[model samples]
Target: MNHFASIARVPGDPILSLMEAYRADSHPGKLDLGVGVYKDAQGLTAIPKAVKLAEQRLLDSETTKSYIGGHGDPLFGQLLTELVLGADSQALAEQRVGATQTPGGTGALRLAADFIRHHLPTRGIWLSDPTWPIHESIFAEAGLQVGHYPYVGADNRLNVEAMLAALNQIPQGDVVLLHACCHNPTGFDLSHVDWLQVLEVVKARELLPLIDFAYQGFGEGLEQDAWAPRLFAEALPELLITSSCSKNFGLYRERTGALLVCARDTEKLLDIRSQLAFLARNLWSTPPAHGAAVVATILADPELKMLWSDELSNMRLRVASLRDGLVTALEPHGLAQRFAHISQQRGMFSYTGLSPLQVKRLREEFSIYMVGSGRANVAGIDAERFAQLAQAIAHVCVE
Candidate 1:
């Protein structure tokens, strides 16, 4: 054996493992409710019409293949900012916002983590108790202490009081990572009133808010979905925003996303941008140009932009419909009261409140795959399979 064989073998990702199991299942009707990526009614992930149009435009244009600058394309960053923060954003107009294109949302988060480690190494990072598992792993890999804040309540709703209590305990200068919208694993999100209270705590406690927004158009409409981040930017003097176009824009493999830094002063903004560029330089050197170019093309074209938004709206509605359908299917089974929270939750996922054993049974017996933690990706279900899923879930839960 080699001398460097001390490393222990680690298990594969729970979500990815479920995907593998789903692929290996011989059952023709096996359903895959694992993974965060979006799937259509046909259970296929395809390029959107807007993306195809953008690709045609890019192919028609004669642009050089040179490497993007340290901060990527300023135009792309500006377009992303306007898209997320709105055109008339006071922060953008006043030059208080700076952004950089990243490989994807993961890249943006890693960059933000690295930035935090450099600037506030002593401060611990707070993530939701039952957040996307990757969040904790990424922060830990960045050599920072990670802590948990209560988010989901026992009733399968947002635990605002417990969240506040956790925030109250956070010392000054710590970083708090918030899912700007569409809380992962558990679709429980903070209401606008709860957001206001959280902002108050952050301001009073002098905590840094790092908002991870991966599914903008997957929740409500584009504008409606962006309310949380826009509000955070306007209320908070300084904030960090990481957004991805993978789900909404259907650019998953293209790895397109951005990291934004909003500060009260221009000098501080410059410092942050410079440090981010430095981090990017050592990391991936520069993000791929194709996805950013494609996004830029779609956003710059009014017709294509409208088409993209419309498609995104359809996807969001489909997921919402599945949520309602699941509840309805469970009603006659006498498990409606237990699963009513599924419909109330928004976005792509819902914490089904199933125990680990039930989740295992769902996979082993029914050939249905979901996260081991009982999180189901609602977007994976079509209208036809709603009854099957609900029946399976009810059977597993009641037994």
Candidate 2:
């Protein structure tokens, strides 16, 4: 008998399964709101102008294809640290912050999880109830006890009060994983006042904050989106931030990101970075070079940096417009009240509040592919098809 024959098959992820189903859908107008990817008005994920230019420059000024390092690109780590923490951050000035590039946000998260499990063995992690689904599995896979704090309510609304209440009860010195900007699956973000309140609780309880800054520019403006993380860095003596270039830089396939570690002093930071490098050696050895190099090239050059910023701003504006447009499209159908939160929510996703049955109807009857939980990718909404999409939404919402 074969020894390896008893492995059980696991079901595919609902989101990826939805994508497969959407692809097999022969409907000419099938819309895909399942995957958490940005799509333009024309329904294409085009590379940014700056990214294209940077790639060209890289091709021309090509050098040896040697390995980057355990920390990948130093320039990328430095630039991304500033981008996430702000240039004037005292943390940077004090040399208390350090970064190590990972494969992507997911990899950075896994790195952080493993680091915590290995180093801070006693500390459990607290995540939002409806956080990016991967957060649960990542920490658990690291053998860390994962607890959830209330975030979104049963009504599919931002229950910040409940979130704070839960946070208050978390064990002291536990790692609290937070979406630094643009809360995923449900685009509801905390206000400035809310951040301050959360900060107070974290300070009081002495919880370690592990911020996941995936969609920085996709929320508000670039600088504005960094507000919460910057605030956290300033208030806390130590922090762990995982920043991704997937959404903002359109480097989705490149898998470029970094795990940022902030300590009370340079000594602690260096030790933390050494441990991360050791764990990373056992993981991927070194992160991919192409994507990080592209990001560094764009950010270091003044002209390319400006162009990239403008492109990022365009993507942000487009997503915001899509959210507003969907809400407006529903107004004439008398759904303004029912779907007002769509306009209010931030980033690519919206907890549209459509029931599972309704979501099934939308996919089967209207060829609109969205998560069964009604988390639609607002970025995938085609500008010209707003009215048609609204009609489908209204029909299902009423049925």
Candidate 3:
């Protein structure tokens, strides 16, 4: 009779909780640098013009509300795979690759986790020591044993040597999750040379690579950012890739993403895709179609594709500029050098080196909000308030 009463209450998401607190604060100069979503200079998350145009076209041409099925929208899958791996990818030419549309990158990841849990039952998963919080929970919920490799060292900088060492020690055949670019929470990314070394280790140890490519065009240009994953796909016989269109296409609420698989040949690729379709059917039944339709429309047309690319480039530039502007603003307080890593780091986030106490002080006294771990969304920074934000940071640094 009391079966439900025995369940315990779960804690709210830390980032979302921070958002609620920020909204409740009455300070005129309150700043929110906690949530991971991209914001404009005016503190708004505006949709791209290309997406608007695509949606309008879709509305005019659409006829029915029929389901798109588990593999959802074949054209979307084809184009998105080309977008992730280059259009001229050898894997595609060889018919060794397949794609399954999912609700979002998160859904894609969950599909991968389930596939690993069911098919590769003996294998465990290895993640970065400080990956996106959801990664930890998702795999565990799927009943897979989860482990972590060192990513950031005591100095709060990328310790690739440590990462590779830990990765080397992991049991052979285990799955290792790697950020393709713009590593989450900590914006630190591996250099091209570093990736080669890691690739060597993975090959020697016989590890399965699962690349998370959530921020493709956010860190670098689309093609430039895809280098590592493309390399891995080319060098390895089997690989899993989860890609997101949230930030690049500004389709956050629409939840459009895909899980791409690369096998040794066409026959094996088909077998893997069949499994993904079955898993996807049990997860979300069918992914929402509007987002994928919009992406396909834009990417299919040359002019609209160019417009979307330009908008994405502008977003990347703005985030990069904000990083530099914040550093420059801190120079008067002699903090530029101390926070110089902020400039070197790419994408929307930076591990700002603020301690938990300092973070608390900023929230209570200055009404400035950021994760307790000091991760800040660089895209959320308002250039007009750079000086004000810098002053607040300086005050916290000295305290």
Candidate 4:
């Protein structure tokens, strides 16, 4: 008997499948906006100069190949914790926050999901309706009950009121996943006032906030982007945070990320961290060290830190410019006002409000590739080909 015959082939991930299709297309003007990676104007995802410099320093310093312990690098944990939660964060001062290094933002999220499943087994996790596709699968794979709260609606806009209404109905003590900035899939983000309203509902519902800080510096200034998470950390007695250095530090492949826990006090934090460490040991004995080590080295050095910050600022500004440019380029087609939200939306992605049919036309008729949900990575746009892209989009919209 064939043992493998019982298993059925699974469908490929939509975004990844789109990538394969884009790669196979022979069109000279093919465009790939499916994957969420920061590409340069030349359409290359090159390593940042500061990251290269840090790697050279790491190479010269001569480090051991031995395991960095179950919790990963201590220096990385310390610095990354401060990077997300301000250095002078009251939670840090009060010894209420603890950090653990993970493979990547996805790993951090998985670790968090496992922790919730094992410890808070009775509580289900709530995600935004149009969250990153991986969010749903990750939690479900961990054997945890998953639910959704409204985020984007039929009108294709951030419906915070609907979101709060859904949150109000969810049982108390359940985990609520919130995007700190640069909301995935849909680029629409909750403003300060919206965050406050959500915070009130969280307090009333006694829900646990699990803030996902994947694109920290991409949406706005790093400091500015941290406002929501920091506010929750300060006000709430317990909070869970997953932060990624992939976008900000351009450390995508290195898989550098951290899961931070904020508790009522040092005693509670220690208990929570012990559980996290135990869970991480089973998931990924020890995370890859090179990425974390490089981040630590750069953050430790003043000059290198400045260089990284400047590079990060440039990437953020470039994405913003692309968003604006795409909208302006659509002006000739009289579609600028219709797609004006592209500029209003921050970060690497935007929901273009293109129907599935329109998206299909862009891929088949033109060579443009984006998710069927109309989610496009703004950072992937090549300014030189903006006019071509605009024409393709206008063509699809009109059809």
Model 2 over residues 10-111: C-alpha lDDT tens digits?
A: 999988899899999999999998899889878999999999999999999978799999999999999999999988999999999999999999999999
- TM-scores for the candidates: 0.97, 0.99, 0.99, 0.99
Q: The CA-based lDDT of model 4 is what? A: 0.93
Model 4 spans > 4 angstroms off: none
* lDDT by residue (tens digit), candidate 1, 162-239: 999999999887999999888997998888899899999999999999999998987777898788889988888899
lDDT of each: 0.88, 0.93, 0.94, 0.93
**Model 3: runs farther than 4 Å from truth?**
none
Model 2 lDDT, full chain set: 0.93
Candidate order, lDDT descending: 3, 2, 4, 1
Per-structure clash totals for the candidates: 0, 0, 0, 0
Report clash pairs, candidate 3: none
lDDT of 1: 0.88
lDDT (10s digit) by residue, model 3, range 321-399: 9999999999999999999999999889899988999999989988989999999999989899999999999998994
Least well predicted 10-residue stretch by lDDT in candidate 3: 152-161
